[model samples]
Target chain A: AQRVTQPEKLLSVFKGAPVELKCNYSYSGSPELFWYVQYSRQRLQLLLRHISRESIKGFTADLNKGETSFHLKKPFAQEEDSAMYYCALKKAGSARQLTFGSGTQLTVLP
Target chain B: NAGVTQTPKFRVLKTGQSMTLLCAQDMNHEYMYWYRQDPGMGLRLIHYSVGEGTTAKGEVPDGYNVSRLKKQNFLLGLESAAPSQTSVYFCASSLRGTSGVAGELFFGEGSRLTVL
Candidate 1:
């Protein structure tokens, strides 16, 4: 079975501090992982995909095959970055269904 | 363009009552999915459709039915509401890819259902 786990339910960090949201997955086939964020009163949207390897809004995530993890990181946190973040994995098949983790609520305190 | 739209953004139903949640996407996506968001449970896939007239159950499908009579629309129906069924439902769509799996999904604002 394929599963995504976000161990932290809530993470708080002060502005300008570094931030890391851990995400781990268990899958038999190659994995395709993504981070999604939802701001207040906003619909959930894609933050970044491991395949892209590109940073979005100063946040980056590298897929670690050895650890089976795709942790999202940011050099400096911002108050605007506070939101609910979810880690999702695309199943390795034609179904293309997304399996999401429980989610992490990040709070950037000033 | 309305990427994805869900009707009845909010609804309340008594237990044992039936209701249907409609999801429509204007992106002409080939795939549509229904998911329910619960506290600390993340989003669980209830059902999905790859194309018109095709439907498949996902991680959680009990007490739910879906239909894709039209390519751009997918409907999720509940035969009888229950307190456990109360949740925020989200509809998402994605374009088909040559790689066999669909791409990034576009989601709607969501529909909050309260079961009494």
Candidate 2:
């Protein structure tokens, strides 16, 4: 079975400050990781995936195999960044299915 | 395109009552999933279908049943609703399982169910 752990339940930061949302996973085989975000009154949507290796809305994540982590980071925080973020993992197998973390509520204060 | 749409956006049910939630996707994706979201529990998969005419159990499936009779639609049924079943249900779809692991999910607006 695959599992994802997002250590922080809530993270608050001041505008212009750097922020990081930590995430860890445990899977026997190679895993695929992704970040999904939900804004107020909106549907959950994909933020980014490890394979893409691209940044969305100034947020980026690097999958660390040795440490078993895939933390999301942003150089500077913006108030508009406030939302709930979830980290998910999919293991390699014929029935590979997604496993999501508890989620972290990020608050970017002015 | 109506990427993903869930019917009965909000519902209130009584214990022992039955209800069914409908999910439809216009994307022609081959994978559809039903998940329930609670305060601190995040998203827990209730049921999923890899394709039409097939459905499988997910993380939390004991209290739920699913049917995927059509390629573009999936339905979740609760024979007897309970307090624990009151949650925000989300329906999502993706291209295909072999299309790779991180196939981004296109989710619906979600259905808020309250059982009292």
Candidate 3:
């Protein structure tokens, strides 16, 4: 039984300020984590993944195995960054299905 | 390339009525998935298919059914519509093989469904 949790349902940040969306997961085996973003009037897309270790749109997330967390972070917020962010987890060798979190609605205020 | 396309972008149905949502991918992906997005609940996997003619239950599979008769098409069916089933549905596809396990998923614009 694996689960992903995004504690904050909504988060607001001023333009140019740093932003952090918290995410935690409960999985005993090794896990692959990813952050998916949905922009206004757009389809959901992958923002970043722990395995790739590459940042997209200036956002990055580090997987913390000890704490069972994979929080998404950005150095500075922009109005265009406002969207729904979901944290997902995939078990190492399961059915290749991802378990998603409740999601965080990030609003970057200008 | 019309990466992933879902037909009937918007649909309204009455309780007890049934309908099917169609998803087609042109990328030749061997894996397809159906998910429902609700406010605050994020996107929950309803069902998924590993390849043609193979389907499996996902996180929230109780109220929905799915089929993957064709390699490029995955269909989600609702036997009886209910208000609780109203949500935005998304279809996604990914490659298969060693790189498929943790590959990125390409998604469709999504289908909005409302059960009255």
Best by DockQ: 1
DockQ of each: 0.81, 0.69, 0.77
- Per-residue error at B48 for model 3, in Å? 0.6
Better of 1 and 3 by lDDT: 1
Q: Over all chains combined, what TM-score does candidate 2 have?
A: 0.96
RMSD of each: 1.5, 1.4, 1.3
Could you tell me which residue pairs clash in candidate 3?
A: none
TM-score evaluated only on chain B, model 2: 0.95
Error of 2 at B10 (Å): 0.6
Top TM-score model: 1
Question: Where is model 3 more than 4 Å wrong at Cα?
Answer: none
Q: Write the per-residue lDDT of candidate 3 for residues A19-73, one digit (tens) a residue.
A: 9999999999999899999899998998888998888889999999999999999
Model 1 regions more than 4 Å off: B98-102
* Model 1: per-residue Cα lDDT over B5-29, one tens digit each: 9998999999999999999999999
Candidate 1, residue B91: Cα displacement in angstroms equals 0.2
lDDT of 2 by residue, B1-116 (tens): 98999999999999999999999999998889999999888899999999999999999999899999999999999999999899999999987656554568889999999999
Ranking by DockQ: 1, 3, 2
